[model samples]
Target: MKVGLLFDARNPDGWRRPWARHYARILELCEESDLRGADGVWFTEHHLFADGYLPQPLTLAAAAAARTRRVRVGTAILQPALRLPAQLAEEAALVDLISGGRLELGLGAGYRLPEYALFGADLNRRFRQTEANIREVRRLWSDGGITPGPIQDPVPLWGGFYGPRGARLAGQLGIGLLHISRPMFEHYRQGLAEGGHAPQTARVGDLLPIILADDPEAAWPRVAPYLAHQMNSYRQAAVEGTDVPPPPLIRSDELRNRDPDGPWGMLDILTPEDAAKRIIEITQGLPVTQLIFWASVAGMPDDLVVRNIELVSEALPPLLQAAHPAHPAHGREREAGPPLAAEGGGRG
Candidate 1:
């Protein structure tokens, strides 16, 4: 029941700050999360997003690594198709070393057509590219001529998935899986077993949007705009053939007494008590290794996001773990394959 915080720094037009300041604030928030009982801090990548999404996650990851001491630093999903495998490997290794072996590499085949076009990459080949990139990156770290590879013997690698294809690919590669829902989590585990690997050989983490407050009714006004913006943005992308599916529309009339089990990808808005109760219920029959709370989203104000993080951190983990103990992901420490054992020295 490790709890991490994800920063989806979407600076929409009306709720925007200067680009430089916006990033600085995100990093500051990451630092705060580290001090306030978070196990990890993660960043996400996107390109050509209308709301000025953070396109360069690795750079921000390095900055976060430098600023934080205890919390692990990670990329929720770094699009492998956008960069050369060797380059991506180098950057990831450096960040791992810089963070004192605290980096979890999360890779993805990006969905947006515009991003692929802008990067001169073929969207149709992205799935293949993602698989290729992971192989090449591992090879470079293990056998390439680079001096000093990652500090972690084989850095923990996780794949982000939009569907079963990605889940199956993750299983085939023997990497961890990042899924948005419980059904996807099951798919990933089944895929792993189908690949002839033990289900416990890989881990699964869930990325969820959560809003925690003493009075959720009073808090909805402040959170709805950001939540709505996030949902609508994904809806638009889905319409354009992005792999992301549109979430059920978030409506004001549907705010109160919302069923926790109603939809697969809707936001979770609850008081601390309800959050603990709902989370316990959600993980009752699930083996979710990590619960990565998406506290900062679509230009929500810093204070509110920080408060939400605190509330979630305080409320969820112990309760859920108490309800469902002995998650296998917490016990597994096997690396997918042996490192190439390259000869290089780097500070980690």
Candidate 2:
């Protein structure tokens, strides 16, 4: 399987650092991942947050592109709602050229009402806007008007949309998806078929919150707080501009419940071998071309996060790669677009 590391440079109140220092540290980690042979390095986006979530993923992607030579760089879910399609296309093109054709664009129709309000994007029409913007982006890429075309013939695209309608739209647009729901994935395939693309063309990639460590029981306490912070930030953003009362922050203790089939928020601290087995079982029949896990989740310490990236680069790939021999992805790994996944599968 293709392996990659993702960072959002989150600096929550308790863990806050100088923003410049944080970005530098994050780039250092991305460099570390690339040196360790990670398939890709990715960034996520957000805005108007107290914790200072990453607001400009393309800016960071460009930075990462400059920092790493071997690793693909990407935006996990850059909202196209905030920028004009031509602007988005041009920026992506520049990053693609900078990375030598290693940019994977994952777009989302944004759910945070506060961000939509700040960008003057209509929340109710965000999906349609995303679709329209994508069409315009394609036009810009193909037409002679765009000054510097992207290095890749067609830059790989993926959707961060999770629901059925959005998933179908993503498929119709011939973009890959970031999802884990099998049922929703079926909708994506149906959309692809409806769009005159083969159903076998459906692909997905997900950013798992899981941590890999030598000792699961021992590592749980150390990573749980950071995981909780990551989860709560997403939850808090969901209620940012809505009438619904924000839920209390997730406690580290609540991350317990290791039952394989239980209703646990289920973030496991696993050894490399166990992490491989879990990934294989979890994605047994899915078209998973990219598999990503958080790098330095919620400002996790460099030493600890570095070890995780090392295991990801060195330990996880062979284990997952071996498993893929028995359960292949029907040659989706050979396709040229979306250079994020490895020869087997790429990362987010």
Candidate 3:
């Protein structure tokens, strides 16, 4: 299995840093992940959050691409409704080029109504717009008239689907799937089969929020604040009907007071051994090609986040070996990518 890092960069009150430093820290951590043999570095997109969540993920992807030599840089879920198709295509293509084609484009029909209104897009028609934008992007890439297209023949597309319709759309387009639900994954595979595509060709990534430390007893308290913030933020979105089948609230009181049995299906704070075992089980028998870890969640402190990255890196090789024995050992390690500019590139 390919191991990667995902940064949402959500800066909650009392834990926030300067925006420039936050971005810089993310890249610095990306460099650390690459050095420690991570396969990719993924960024999430949000807008107008109280904590100043990342709003421009493709731009962030470009920044990540510039800083590291090997780690694949990607946007976890860039809303297609927010940009003109051609303009989005141009920006993505440039990032892919700068990264030497190491870009995984994950597109989403954005959930937040406020975000849709802010961008002057119709929330109800966002999915349709997403579909149309993707088609236009494909056409642009195929057209010979367009200069400086993405270096990857088709630039790997990973559709972020939360429901059956989106699953079918992903299948019809033959792109990879991200943050997949089990039902959606089945639907997507079925759709692919109906479309005359090989089922094994489907790439699925599982997003798991994890933190590692020597003493779980000691670490959970430190990481719990950010975890609570992360969960509560999602809960609020779900309550607002942005995400359906609402996520369980990881209560702040429980975390702050170190309540045992805090929450399941959310943050998995474990020791290296436990984490490795759980990852193996969580990913086993699934189409999970990539295991994306949300390490620096809710803007956790730089030191704690770095330690989490180090622990995961140390455990990943063995975890990959046990979970995906068919592949060569080197598959667990990071692969070298494009040349890095002296000044590095894309930090907006």
Candidate 4:
């Protein structure tokens, strides 16, 4: 059960200041804490939101790679339709080189009508565009010859699928799948088998919101509103045919009525222990090879975020160690990545 941290870096207060400083600190923490327990770090791409979310992911991945030593870095998702396939391939290769081949490329079709409208892309053709983009990217990276080609061939690509077609495409293309929840795992497994890739051991990651608190009661008050905000945002977005499900705010009742094929209901209430236990169950039942948690959402303060990381680190070891008893506990915590340096000096 490999763990990774996902950062949206949503500046909900609006971009009153440059994000470079904040991002530097974030990367520094990622390197340090990732060494402590996390297996990887991930970031997302969005354009022109009131929250000042990052629009570029490969750039961010490169920055993160430079800061960290052992932890793998990747985009939680790259909106493929926004990029030319060849350009995306080139950037991916460069980042992979920068990270010494420690890149897990997660590609997705563009969502958000605002972004598509801004980019002049037809939203209806998203799946088609993604398919084309994926095909072209593979060709450029694996088959196309450059005058000066990349140091490595065929970087690992994970297809981010929200539905059945995308899952089938991933298996057909022999790429890993990135799903949002556990039920989607069944779809991937079925898709892989149907695609003539039976018994596949391909990688899959589940994305979820996570926080670890000293006390659930104390943490709940602080974290709940932020979690609710996230849920509301998703609910609003889902109405636009985005497939962003509402968070599971009312657990017991929601759990009883849970749609096996739908996204997870709001998870803002689960304690760290319950969250970890749920995660283990989901991973064990699903074909998930990696688990990525959205660690810094709702504008969480840096100190609280670090404490959350520590909590997760503490909680995960015994579980993972017990699960893999044959392996020795090589949990030697490493120092966090270097502090965000000046423009030229820092990993970014």
Query: How well is each residue in 1-348 modelled by candidate 2, as lDDT tens digits?
Result: 577888887888876777887788788778777777788899888999788888999999999999998788988889998889989999999999999999999899888899988888899999989999998998999994587999997899989988999889988999898876688898899889888888778888888757787777876777778778878888988998899999998788886745667532446677889988888887878888888887777876555676787777777877887777764422233212222222112111
* Candidate 3 lDDT over residue span 1-348, tens digit each: 676788887877776666787677678778878877777888878887778788889888888888888778888889988888889889999899999989988898978877888889898898899999998898898894366899999888988887898888888788888864677788888878877888878878867766777787877766777778877886676446354466677765575444456533667677877887876775556677777777676876566676677766656656567656786324544443342222222221
RMSD of each: 8.9, 6.0, 5.4, 5.7
Query: Candidate 4's residue-wise lDDT over 169-231, tens digit each?
Result: 777677788885555556666766766775556667767655666676665655555555555
- For model 2, the stretches where C-alpha displacement exceeds 4 angstroms are 258-266, 326-348
After superposition, the stretches of candidate 3 with alpha carbons farther than 4 Å from their true spots are: 239-250, 255-264, 328-348
Task: Count residue pairs with overlapping backbones in model 3.
Answer: 0
Superposition error at 40 for model 4 (Å):
0.4
The lDDT of each candidate is 0.76, 0.81, 0.76, 0.67
- Index of the highest-TM-score prediction: 2
- What lDDT would candidate 4 get against the real structure? 0.67
Displacement of residue 187 (Cα, Å) in model 1 is: 3.9
Q: Superpose all Cα atoms of candidate 1 onto the true structure and report the RMSD in Å to 1 decimal.
A: 8.9
lDDT at 96, model 1: 95
For candidate 1, report its TM-score: 0.85
**Local error of candidate 1 at 43, Å?**
0.6
Candidates sorted on lDDT, descending: 2, 3, 1, 4
